[model samples]
Target: MSALRIEGYVIVSADGMLANAKHVMPDSLRFKGDQEFFNAALDRTGLIVHGRHSFEGQPNSPKRKRLILTSKTAALAADPSNPNAVLWNPAGATFDEACDCAGVRSGTVAIIGGPEVFAMFLDRYDTFWLSQAPHVRLPGGQPCLPGVPERSPQAILAAHGLKPGEPQILDASHDVSVTPWRRAG
Candidate 1:
């Protein structure tokens, strides 16, 4: 079997915030370009992994095959409501075990986020697609990664051995751009 490759997808404000102080993703961070790009990438993934908030924030989330990371679960457990989802506690079970429980044998695993989930896979991502809304800034907002406001996302990626690629303009009207950060050799 092929190794399971992990990829991350996130959009942040100029200040590196994924959500406001209330832990809500604001409309300011939403862009047509970013949404389209994100949807396309996620559609190809064998499985999606994220926190509860991230799952709910997404549209049509129940239709996707995913693992919802949550402390409420002791380990990997099937979601009663959604047959396509699994509830997982990282501390209770290994990621590989979670994948087995989720029935995703091997393929790209898309790691979408709520900060902690993003941080957990820092060392595992084959490519992290970092999209930015450069004009939006959220003070006292929830960071995309744990160290934001103290450290820039670029710095955090570099520290984890990821290198940024050329950013492509996704939305010229909103100045939304996406840069793919790949694991450095």
Candidate 2:
């Protein structure tokens, strides 16, 4: 079987932070245009992967299939609150096996992340939709990818061999921009 086509979607601050020091996405970090962009991406995404923290307290559970990355569970099991979500332990199931279990075939798999989740798929992503809120800054916040010297989002993407495309200015007043990067040929 062919490998999965993984794509990642993330919103970082100009300083390269994904979340505040509290490790939570605050209201200050969210922009309407970014929300719309993510919603649109979700519409076409067949499967989604995200960290446990990213899935917690989500106002509403989406209907699409989702894999919540958690090491606490060894077996894949349904989330009690959201029927469409499942707890996934990557150590136990390979991506292919997880797809098989989810009854998903070849298609775009979007990963909404916490830093580690982003780091894990560094070399596996076919595309990464990176958004930035330049006006937003959270001092001592979580870097986009941890365990390495913090760097700009572009630098991180380029290091992983992903080339950035033209950026879309989502909200000029808010300084929100989104760039789509694909693996370089």
Candidate 3:
């Protein structure tokens, strides 16, 4: 079977909200640790998948093969200059079908997200790379995985067969922890 991986940089408060929902990646929040984790995951991934909003938020680059998933037909367009980019409508096709069309075989397929995208592929993902920011609070922020009713992300991941592998404290000042999870066979 082909492998799917869920990976994202999340800034969570002590209360468990993932981010300010208004912004996917806020400039106000520092991500030095997340950057390092992303680099490592990128090294192993052959393709990346993301929601339309996340794709739009990214800096345009031709380096990686990317698939943007959306229900709306107009959410994405071909990048004439970058032939590696593909717009995938999940309504018309399954994520696996999209990956096959993109030529992502057994190698890692990184799912970078907005919550809906994460929720969509959580069951199929083989691994998870998460950045957990400790001791912060975003009272009105959006949850990392929405609609879960304040469950521990770690426990949820464990339930999905993902075991914690590598963990490092990124910043002593901010107490952000970068952790990697691998599927238990």
Please give each candidate's TM-score: 0.96, 0.91, 0.80
Q: In model 1, which runs have C-alpha deviations exceeding 4 angstroms?
A: 56-60
**C-alpha RMSD of each candidate structure in angstroms:** 1.4, 2.0, 3.2
**110: Cα error in model 3, Å:** 0.9
Higher-lDDT candidate among 1 and 2? 1
Tens digits of per-residue lDDT, candidate 2, 1-185, equal 35568899888887888888999888888888888888888778788888888852333347788888888889677778777887888998887777777777877888888888888888988999999998888888888786433567788888889999999998889989999999998
Q: Write candidate 1's Cα lDDT for 15-88 as tens digits.
A: 99999999999888889889889988887888999998886345755678999999998998889988999999
Give me the overall lDDT of model 2: 0.82
Consecutive 10-residue window with the lowest summed lDDT within model 3: 53-62
lDDT, ranked from best to worst = 1, 2, 3
Candidates in order have lDDT scores of 0.91, 0.82, 0.66
